[model samples]
Target: MHTSSTNNDQTTELDALLQILTTQVASLQASYRTSNTTERIPSLLKLKNLETLGPDSDPSLNETRRLIVSAATQLIHTVQSPIEIVQDYAGSTFKTVALGFVVDVNIPEVIRDLGGEKGMHVDDISVHVGIDTSYIARVLRYLATRHVFKELTPNVFAHNRISILLCKRRSFEEIKADPISRFDDAPFAAHVHMFSDEILIETLSAFSEFLKQKDLSSESVKDGNPEDTSASGPQSSAGLGPRTAFNLKFNTSKSFWEWIAQPGAKYEDLARTVAVVMRGGDKMVDEGQLVNAITTAASGTPIDSSTTDITNLLPLVVDVGGSSGSATFTIKNKVLQDVSGIKYVVQDLERPIDSARKFWAENDPRAIETRQVELLVHDFFTSQPPSCQNASIYILRMIIHDWADGEAKKILKRLREAAYPPLPLSTQAVSPEPKTGPRSKLIVFDTLARYTCDDPRENLNRSGKEGSTSVPWPLLGNLGVAGEGFSTMMDLGTMVALDGKERTRDDFEQLGKETGWKLESVKPGKLAAFIFSAF
Candidate 1:
């Protein structure tokens, strides 16, 4: 009798929670002008967070949009989990096959070339794409159910917001058409191809094995390869290859860089894609913010006007380990005019230097002609090439956290040492130190994961639509997949691909303290964090 009463009480509590979720969902519909009780998916899909239906900032809509998404998520899972669990788990194979087919054959491009918003008939699309009509239709129809593409009529198809990404081009094109390369510099395509072909399959087989090999019984696997991170180990070329899953899978006795740098390595496309990915930092805090931080911090020390010589006022911006020099271009464009005689330098390996040179020559010839941007081949794990050391500003984007704290600190320490550049005496003479000036500032751009406990509805701006404010306990800062999304996925992939991990603000704090640098300020954005550093 007591057990029955307890069950009844628990069921009542769940029923109440469900009622709350349903009430909020209804409120969301009413606010969005779809309050009609009969409308089902049309209303559900209009919720904005669920689908990419394009931007609509209706003033009359309720401000707490995240609540609606959260409530709906909870309610849907509650109602669908029993049935969805089995299908979603086992059905991945079919979806993978269908997605792989479309990606491999460039179906998205065909559908796009045929008609984007208006869409194309299945027969016409198949004919244009040179695939069998019935087979393509069956696969697309299956994908439509998953919201990848849209089936307008029985045989017609249209590009949804998601499908448009897989097309050769983008509506908001951040990456440009690479005329030099045979493959399109399509970031999404590269991501899909790499994930589906290399990363996903490689990870599945090696993720478990790596743990077992590293002695899963001891949980200290969290410290990923301490020797590789230490000052001495990074200098040595031994025992670094097998530490990574990609190296292990390929059975290469070389580090990721050495392996990729070999002639005919066949990763040129992936290299281009990575350049696009590195430039993706623009989605977060404005590039100008970093520009402002560096320039302002380096200001106030004026050259003596009594001498009337501007030759001693040379300032340098070194983007350390800056693959492809993506950020370098942005920094140069933003501040080259404002800060006269400032030289922009991108220090990286031979591959990135070559890639950046090609990209910049075509993209921004002014930078090349003015001779403002110089690509220097220098390894970050070593001392900054003396030529670029003690620059006015040093920026590292996504460089740290590729190894354990031990290695991350070594990189930081080198940057710290380099920030105290020897003062150059005008034009031809070299001096030991800057006569009198501020130390160069080091700014790192990466994700600074943190739990921000704030009311979701407090900051009532349409910016709220970003869903980046503090989410409830279960969700991430971006309201991404309940605590496991791109960052988490990439974190794991880094472990396998490069033996790296993402760091929290605390981890950075420890790294900073150990590396002889002070944490100036942590500007956390919706996606990336701009961490400031000083000696």
Candidate 2:
């Protein structure tokens, strides 16, 4: 009994010692952790503070600690997500800039307003643009988030440096004084109707139907016999596959150019709207420095020679698919002014020519008398004429995205053929040593399919619709799928009216490659965003 008791005591003592050692080690570990955590608290807090404060806060270190604290407080704000607030502010500003397009509804007047470095304010802007105050303010608010305007308080806005390139500045009075021709104000904005409207919906719906049918088009076969290759062929027949069936059933009598050329059409609204948007900041050639920038960017060559005589060097310039000749008008005024033998050819359709002629005749008799530009009715999908062969340049301004791959290829092929015509029988052997160089370049000015530079402010203006103040979320989402300015209302009209659709940059390039044209480079600007050069 004594031995057992002694053993029990010893076991109890050993357990107590083990517990004490464990307690000491745990205490040491906790102390170390607490010390380490205390050391890092300030750093973690400092990192958490950066989310606060305005993006343009002073960088001076005099009040660095105070600034950090302030930033933390602002960063922790729960009223609105910082991103949301910024986006809203940007949207407000973008709306303001974009609404200008809708308000002015007059291209020349808009350009005239933007001729100088200092742009007009909302109130003064309203007077020039003929838009109401309340609506303009709302639009400006949305544009603000996008940084389209520096809201120097409510009802006032100062244009940004980059905003000055949206449009080519022009004298409204001069445009008014000149003949109101079709080319003078072709409905440029209205062209976006196809992508925004019924055509896209219909196309996608058809695609969905195709997918449902195991990747087969849902149209009925034309012939009763299974052996009839016409059922599977790429030919058009009534009640056939989607491509062929739609080709025949959905046949449009009037081409897009023809439809827009209709006398007294609503293109006037589009013209005036684009004019206002352009003039908002896109000052015309009046700013010689801006012109030089554009010239350098467009030409992709150094302008080193002081007396290169830019005008005389350009002989025959073809404005391919130059709707209403807005780009041509700007370029001619800016670059080709001194070139004596310069002749501008604006190609579209007989319909565009008729209105363009009327517009030219009514507006600028001297311009017409000088014969600076000749309107040519031509489809870009067909063969390019000899007159345009090896021309000094062919400028396709905002034209390439109007069709799908197949149609775009046809257009590109036409241009490519023009650049490199078939060797004649007589000159086949002596074909100028095979040229051994890239020539007859193609200039394209248009929007990218779904890409844009990060300017929360400018994006709103570029994508917003006329009359509405709210930023378009749906349109933004659909930019990659459809386009930025898409409208179902416009698509139905296009199908019944214009027979055209918008395309993406990828679509354009893919089509270009199929047509033996190589994409050389792309110059992205503020207004249209991208200019593609093809060889």
TM-score result, candidate 1: 0.71
Candidate 1 lDDT for residue 161: 56
Tens-digit lDDT track for model 2 on 453-476?
Answer: 233322222232222232222122
TM-score of 2: 0.43
| Candidate 2 runs further than 4 Å off | 1-314, 362-364, 420-438, 451-505, 526-535
Give TM-scores for every candidate, taking all chains together and pairing residue i with residue i. 0.71, 0.43
